[model samples]
Target: MMAFANFLFIVFLLPSLEALSNVNPSEYQQELNTQALILQACSNVENLSSCLSNFQGELQKSGPPTAQSIIHAALRATLDEASRAIDTITKFNSLSISYREQVAIEDCKELLDFSVSELAWSLMEMNRIRAGIKNVHYEGNLKAWLSAALSNPDTCLEGFEGTDRHLENFISGSIKQVTQLIGNVLGLYTQLHSLPFKPTRHDHNATTTKSSSDKFPEWMTEGDQGLLKGSSLGMHVDAIVALDGSGHYRTITEAINEAPSYSTRRYIIYVKTGVYRENIDMKRKKSYIMLVGDGIGKTVVTGNRNFMQGWTTFRTATVAVSGKGFIARDMTFRNTAGPLNHQAVALRVDSDQSAFYRCSMEGYQDTLYAHSLRQFYRECEIHGTIDYIFGNGAAVFQECKIYTRVPLPLQKVTITAQGRKSPHQSTGFSIQNSYIFASQPTYLGRPWKQYSRTVFMNTYMSALVQPRGWLEWYGNFALGTLWYGEYRNRGPGALLSGRVKWPGYHIIKDARTAKFFTVAQFIDGMSWLPSTGIKFTVGLGN
Candidate 1:
């Protein structure tokens, strides 16, 4: 019995001794690796030593840390700075200020509010990974939100063009530091494979359906299926807008106001055959709202607001959707504020998981302001001129027709002005399997932001496309940073011989290399598009 007790002592004590013996070699080496990787991430960041300090406490607390954890800490740091900026903006607004100062401050407040939302979104995505809800698209989504958050301060500074430099100085320094931190985090995220911890991915089954027996996807109810099938019988029409006294609401706004907030199921609003001239809006609370129409041209929602008419570009949408999971089918959204009335927007959609099928957006400039979030457009007609398809949304357009109208002779006809401000952002124009028909001489797009990205794949471009293919936004700006690519495109203007020779422009050599911009890889559309009943190809198809 004495020998057995002594043996147990030796057995337990050895591990402790062994742990102490190798602690310096193994653990210290791991910490060194962690520090090295994080330091590499802090490359190009201002005040590198201060930025490294933010990770010190987080790194010391745990075993080895991951890029994910580092990103979470980075976001926390960014949010704190942004919150302080908000407080400063609010305090400044209450003080005595001129009209220019007031307007600029108000605009800055609104933009900072959006930046806060973007940070919140980034945090949510990070937390989702922690909650074990693994998603391949989480990286893409986080990049988009963080990039937008970083760009907000820059965008706010743009709004203060004529205002005093003092006001811009107030928010610029603090927010600029915050954006630098965000950029550092994004740079770290690119090394996720090198960092520890792989997300245990699970199948995202929320937007996919398996229905062999029905004519529609399983997520669709009997009523919605019937309505989309060209009959109103058995249709669960939540609201209807008609010109005569034959519907639930006379105007589209009335029907939108009636939509219940936070609805899990769809609230179908059927608009009858009429040109209902109204600027429609759907707020954030009104999720899962479906707008069905009699037909594309038959049911029109038109507005004539423009920047020239004293309205901001954001406020000029004929139909602005801010809800999540919004769907619009068989409709035409138009802004009659023609080409001369610059910056007129026909449809402004900033909704997540929004889908537009078989619709038409008609305007000369800013035809479709796909402002943000994940969006899908299939079989739609978008007519515009001069930086029309603009915004920083992670958007995809499949089998659509994009027509360029005549712009002011001096006003260059550029189809897209994608505002992706960061290299890591997943936001860009992925025009795949589409047609670009030009009524005037046009360029494919110009870099709207430093790291702007736009890809045209498996599409046809008309001959009127300018020989240079892409025009520069400004002299020597974004020429090396922007990413513009073309793959397997056909037609008179698809030739690569005359395309921009910028370092960022690529004539993709093969399908495998170009697959990164496909529907499946870019936005993870396969997880959602099946439910929308939209025809989309996952990759370069025969």
Candidate 2:
């Protein structure tokens, strides 16, 4: 009986043990490769140890790792550690992989060229992060080891190559999936790190020469006096109060109430970073007053004023500026009332010669009311749904972004509903070299009055714009005198052949007539504006 038992053990149990012991050569090789890749990819000591510990456990459990499984495990483990760290590692892997995958996508051959450039850009970003990591101080020896690993070309390149292949193969199999993944993962990273990559004065000057329409001339020059003088001019005010460290007053209206009358020199108010929830009314004496904030997105002034809330369409404004020469920069004005309510104004600039630079005006309906005077917006973002940028003022939008959100039913209307009452007012809305985007289909312009005028010149119109660029307000017959025209507009929505036949729109067949709207003419930009650190074009030669 003992002999028989021993034979059974040898035949069954021994074979089972041996089968478990014998690791596949391919899997063993793959496991080793995966371990090396993970080690090289680790950004810090803690992450490195965590990755290595996970790998050891994985190896003990599986004996060996399949190439695909190992790669997947490594990525999953990295992502589990830290959100930012995982993003950095995945982006590093995606460059070459994205390129390979994009090339293999069916019917995407035409887009391959753009994909290559994008891949190169991702590589550059990875290189930059690697370089930045060296300067970061960590607690221990992990930093030294990570630095050494990054410097080792063979190990780094090997891991990079493997990840590249994985991405390429995955993307090739499902182009849309890979594209979406890359966009989500890398896009978030890019957005998080966007501040570092923003263009500075030096960068901008190196890229584009001084044109007549530039709003930042002082930053473009070699003289410190220009900057100091501009600052002094901007800082000049009737009354001043250092807010201690408070950064902001109790209310914007309080600050204005404390301000001296028009007889006093222009009042200057400097606000710090904080949410100011109050409606502001700038009377006539507030002329030449400047309101400066830390940043447009950071320093926010918000309210819930809409036409439906017992306030007139003109009175329901978070901020109503009636003072002339009112300049506001680096501040956000927002209205909480949504588009469904209609005519929710975040800002109503009724003052003449009022300018907004590097600011943000946000709301749903009638976000910005350029009610009267000459207004200029440079590098500003204006967001709304219906008639977001409107009024009787002669306003110029230069290098700005216009956003249109979806509106409720029966509220469908134009993005800009210009209300110029007469041509003698020298009032119109001119959008120049700007971007117009809509969350849903929208008309470019609509007549709000008898002689409403709006012009889009050298602008980018997104496909969300309706086929007919202009719409008559309430289907009014008086729109025959409304001037709605487009010159040198690019994008799918700027098809002029399909536009409405309005007498006010001049096809602009010649360059001479078009020159009237150039940067120089818009601001008479070459004279006083240049001293204020602005440069306008002399002619089309720019």
Candidate 3:
């Protein structure tokens, strides 16, 4: 009996102990590889030790780090950092602070909430990718989420400006640590994509064909088609709004506020030709709201909100759309907030899967804010000075007109500021088959973030474009990570030799690569854009 008991202990308990003590070879190798990758990527980041320490416990618990596992680890660290910010800000909010400081603290809390949500979303996307459920929109969605995660903190810090320097510094330090962790995660995600091995296709059911408008999906109903072409005003929709009190509502907001929340159907609001001097905010609950007006200049929505008024830049949009599936056509949204005021946004679109057709967004500074998600601008005119067309959304401007407002003295002009904060994000400004005309010396874009991306393809540029096609953001060495590219752009401003010799700048030779920036592929416009019935050239040549 004693011998048998000893045998059992040796075979069962001893082996179990051994298993716990020793790492499996495969697991060991995976961990080593992951560490190597992290070290390789974070070599330049001075906070490497702190970054690793933040994620170490999570990474160890995760076991055998695959690309997804590393990404998960990074996200966990970022989320933890965001939580600290939340706690810090919450404590700050409870203090005896000045009115401006209180406001800034409140803003910080909201932004920290956003950061947490975005980090959570980044984790979710990684899980989805791991589970073989590939979303065509996943890349852009993930990037926009992480970028928002990073940008919100910066914005929060900006709010604290002139409020309290010590508080601002404290908040900045906390947020900056989190931002670095996120940035490292972004770099890791990008590394996964750049790996030589082809990623195993887990989503066998997903269609992998190149975007061709010929394969329109079931969502493109005939009624939808009619609305796209300006033929149908969607009269069957909930209401008609007119400035002259000819319809159910006189103001656009009145109609929007009364509409069914999250209604799947199009809530059409037809605005007759007249200048309406009001700020219109299509709230999130008012999904699928469609606004149409008598062609551009005739039917206008205008405002005069500027940064000089102490309003947050995000709050200064003339026509702000946070609703999903929002559509605007044949109208002009203008911020008469001149160049002197700085950072005045004409139209700020935070809507997901939103679209603008034949619309004009006119302002002197910070004109159009493509704030987030997938957005498409077709046959539209965007006029601005400075970083006029800005934000972190995966946006496509097809066959549109990009106009540059005259700049104030010593105020250099840039057309787009693609604020992609993460390398993993597919968000960028893809100006395809568009026309760029400016009165003053202009640049195609400036890097607004570390990994800013802007591409111009088959577009026409006037001679007013500066010889140095793209400029840096002050002295920022963003050229190394910024993705500024041009392809088949014609006219005097299309001089490739005179363009910046930045490491991230590209002169595209492959049509296929250029095609990636097209409306069909870039924004996944082919799937749902056709439903709007707006005629769009979905390809480079079209």
Candidate 4:
């Protein structure tokens, strides 16, 4: 019996001893080689050289620590080395090319891809070491200590098991950090690459450019060409319509139907200040269209189309955009259907690369349907009661105001319902530099399905945002894979002290880990988008 007790004690004590064992020399050597390869992949001369130096120093400093400690130290060193490499990449500049001209800057992009892949593989190996520790027997409450260390989502290693919350959180955080580093690296790459080797001199004899060009400001123009000027493009609208009181078009549909669809020139149907009571749909071939209104608050497009009306929640849209490259600025899309009538969408955007600027979208349920493809919304207002912003698309909401109208009596709900379907689709909503307000108490978001992913970054939230910011939509078992996180958020809603036990939502404490959702990573704004005069934020710090 005494021998058995000693055996048990030995078994228990082995894990702690193992924890102190020297890190595998082979693994350490492999990490060094991989780090060098990753740095070379970044292709930044200065960054690569600096990282190489740092990596050598770290390896030399690694001494007689246990295998677990050495592994931890190695992971930390790898992360630091990766960060330095990313910093170097961020300083790179992009090469400039004439409009419609193809540039050969794929080298940097390819290098970045390889680096990211290598980093991902390295992280996986680190996770394996972490997982192995769990199986190690420890002495004198070593399990408790191990549990505590692993409890910290950052250091805990993870495996492929679906129930491993620690691993999930760690990967989420790591991905976010790596993404940001990639962004910075890309930003620097663009800047450096775009620099002209030879500077051009100005000619004083050239004709002076007009002080007030007819072109619309570049900020207002879509990605196509120069902005449309009222003088050059003729009157923006052939006619003006107001629905509140005096106007030619009484209902919103009338104005839309009467508007010329096949104009050779770009035509904008400017709606004057008023709330139009009608559901609007833009059919196919409604090309080169632009909808401009007085303001989001003053110009409202609203309707009540619910599921009971034989309409799928997707079809019952107050305003549906089917035409490609459709643009709506300073307007409001609203569905009057209360929560009692579920699945009423205010706006369904089926068009590709559609953009909404300074607009407002409001509804009780399924308010904004970012249905398909990539969509961008900036400085807009979105309000809804339940699953308000739900869809499967690569949609980005930047510097927008999100409000949750008080849920009516008998209604218990959450706010955002991101319905991302797959990991490869690149379809999800990124809410950055935004504000979340709840008219009634609400949860920040809930998984609409398995693999549903949404990110909120540098946003402000009200107390109405529940401490458990995310809730499960029904009891979907697949939600274990859903990705949700909050970083550097302020207000009562930001408190993560008593968050739910689910492994999806992460309170990212490190700024390095919050980069995945930044402007650079989400849209590669650093390269092509900055020319638009839109300020693209870099890194995870606000």
TM-score, each model? 0.84, 0.55, 0.80, 0.54
The candidate 2 region of ten consecutive residues with least summed lDDT is 137-146
**Leading candidate by TM-score:** 1
Pitting candidate 1 against candidate 4, the one with the higher lDDT is 1
Clashes of each: 0, 6, 3, 25
Off by over 4 Å in 4: 1-239, 243-266, 509-513, 524-541
Please provide, for model 3 over 1-542, each residue's C-alpha lDDT reduced to its tens digit, 9 standing for 90 to 100. Answer: 44543343344334334554578877656655765665543334345555545565677866666776777777887788789878877876656266556667776786677678778878887777767885656655565567667666777777765554667766677777666666666667666743422333222112233222444335445554555545664334567777777888888878888988978876777787889898987766678888888889998999998877766677778998977789899999999989889888899886768889899999988899887778988889989889999988889887899888788999889898888877667688999888998888998899988889899988999999988899889785688999888998999999888788889999998877787777666776655676655556666764
lDDT for each residue of candidate 4 in 282-388, tens digit (9 for 90 to 100): 86456446777778787888789886554545457899885645778778898888877877899987554466777899888788977654567778898888788
Residue ranges of candidate 1 with Cα displaced over 4 Å: 1-23, 33-64, 94-107, 134-137, 161-166, 197-215, 230-232
Expressed as tens digits, the lDDT of each residue in 1-542 for candidate 2 is 44553343344334434554568877656544544443433322332344456644543443344332333333333223323322333443335434323222211321222232323333344344435543121111111111111111111112223133654343332333223222222322322333343222111111133433444433233332232233433343333323344533556677777766663333557676778888987875666666766677777889997766545456667998866567777789999999767778899875545678678999988899876645777778989888888776667787888888777887775778776543333457888778887777889878876777777877888887887787777766556787777878888887788787777766665555655554445443333344434332344332
Clashes of 3: 3
- Candidate 2 regions off by >4 Å? 1-248, 263-267, 522-528, 531-542
Name every residue pair that clashes in candidate 2.
212-535, 212-536, 212-537, 213-535, 213-536, 213-537
- Please tell me which model should have the higher lDDT, number 3 or number 4: 3
Top-scoring candidate (lDDT): 1
State the C-alpha lDDT per candidate: 0.76, 0.56, 0.75, 0.56
Taking the tens digit of each residue's C-alpha lDDT, what string does model 1 give over 1-542? Answer: 44554343345335435655657777756655655665554444555555555555554443346666666766676676677777877776755255556666766676677777878888888778767785766766676666666666665666555456676777677657766766766666665733554544343322233222334666667766766666667777889889895999999899999889989777889899999999987876788888999888999999998876656576678999978789998999999999888989999877777899889999999899887778988889999998889988888898899998888768989999988887777788898889999979999999989888999988999999887899899898999999999988889989889888999999988766677777676776766666775556666654
Mind sharing the TM-score for model 1? 0.84
